[model samples]
Target: MILFCPPGVYRAQSDTELLAGRLARHAAGRDVLDLGTGTGALALAAWREGAASVTAVDLSRRCVAATRLNCLLHGAPARVHRGDLFEPVATRRFGMIVANPPYVPSETSVLPRHTPGRSWDAGPDGRAVLDRVCDGAADHLEPGGVVLIVHSQVCGPEATVERLERTGLTADVVERARIPFGPVMRSRANLLERRGLIEPGDRLEELVVVEGRRG
Candidate 1:
């Protein structure tokens, strides 16, 4: 699908595609929610997979506009909202929730307040957004609903699974991909190494998709 991604909106990458592929399997004929729906890629993918409806939420206004434009361009039935994760849809629940949130560990504990970095930086442990998603997923999901979240293994996939399980959902790592370091990860390789998150010579990072299902 052709999408208009302006300067500030995140371009769809491997993590996005991986999560979208997973979405296609379960989103068909269901109500879907795409959190941090940059460029509306996953939301559009869900729509194409026959989702009854799709709602996309992003913290950036530019992303919200970009998603809205892409939905309009593709004639996809997706509603775009600009707010923090799960905030805009406080009173709503969905059959499925998908997200490719910021999971790149940064040097600081605080999240970025600007563009680009805000799309990928998730504090020192890279769990700032991932943890929030995992913590709140159960409350936002309908009975038998599932939440799919993609993040780097460096950010602790086990922690995510444990968190989701603690929320009363059965969770597991459903997909994984080993990709060479991108600009962000490459830039932080030394830091990650010092922090023991990665080996001294490691250059590739494993991205994992964690799926949580409510009983």
Candidate 2:
């Protein structure tokens, strides 16, 4: 995904948002939440896709600042906040929620030399962030609302489905994409453990997305 913004504003991009943009079918005038809106990419996309109101949140002050600027750049009335998960928007719920949270695993995550954004970490098994998002998803989604997220095959879509189901939310793989893990974040073993892709003692190699919605 491309990060479009002026030089001064810090920006970050995620392949998850690229997939979310394609999967999001929100209609205009519907309220939407763009969680972890690093550069407000998803929020901007949601607005462009016809969302009536788009609110975004990020844990980093830099991200919040950048999102605000980006929203203005696109003339979008997106409310940007700095907080973890749903802290900033606790009082409000939405018809649609879109996020590309930091699903990277901690053990494998090696901070980039020039990290531009805050939300990319892949977690302890690359599912830390994804798991948290799924756990609290049901409470925030409005009736009939759906959440679109991008994760890796490394996170095990099947497992993700089971987790969401426990919360009364149906899950699906809206889109799938891959990139070799040799480049960024190491720890093939950790990735395999999260996805259960390995045989009790095998190595790992791919990543994918697992999308879900309240049932």
Candidate 3:
């Protein structure tokens, strides 16, 4: 599917597609939420998968506009909102929530305040946004609802599962893939190695989809 990603809006990458594929398997006739919905890729995928409705939320205005355009282009019935994760849909609940948030371990403790890096940099441990998503998902999920999130193993998938579990959701790693380092990971290889997050000469990273279900 063709998508319009203006400068600074993240294009759907491996993580996005991975989560989308998993979402497709269960989204049929369900209300779906796509957090950090860059380019509306996952939202559009959910719609195509027969979701009853799809609501996409992103913190970036560019992403919001891009998602809106993509939805219109495909005639998908999706509502796009510009806001921080979960905030725009605080009063709404969905059968499924999917996100491919930033999980690239960075050199600094602080996440990017502004710039294209905001699309992928997730602070030093790469769990800044991931943690927020995990901690807040259960509140917006319907009973028996599922939350699918994809991120690098370097960001600590176990922690994500634990966080969701603490929020009273049954969580597990549903999928895993070993993919070559992308541009951001490649550029941070040295730092990652120094931090012992990856071994020397490691050019590949494992991505995992963490699934959390509200009971």
Clashes of each: 0, 17, 0
lDDT of 3 at 59: 89
Cα TM-score per model: 0.98, 0.79, 0.98
Residue-by-residue lDDT tens digits, candidate 3, 56-162: 99988889999999999999989999899998998999999999998888777677756889888998899989999999999999998999999999988999999
Off by over 4 Å in 3: none
Name the better of 1 and 2 by lDDT.
1
Model 1: residues >4 Å from true position, as ranges?
A: none
Q: Cα RMSD (Å) per model?
A: 0.8, 4.4, 0.8
What would you estimate as the lDDT of candidate 3?
A: 0.93
Task: Quote the lDDT for 165 in model 3.
Answer: 99
Looking at model 1, residue 71 earns an lDDT score of 94
- Candidate 2, residues 1-215: lDDT per residue as tens digits? 34555543334444744555564566466788888787888888888888878899887767778788778877888888889878898888788878777655555446432354234565556676777788887789888877777766656778778888788988877666555454344545555556655555543344555666765
Pairing residues by index, what is the TM-score of model 1? 0.98
Clashing pairs in 1: none
- Compared with the true structure, all predictions reach lDDT values of 0.93, 0.69, 0.93
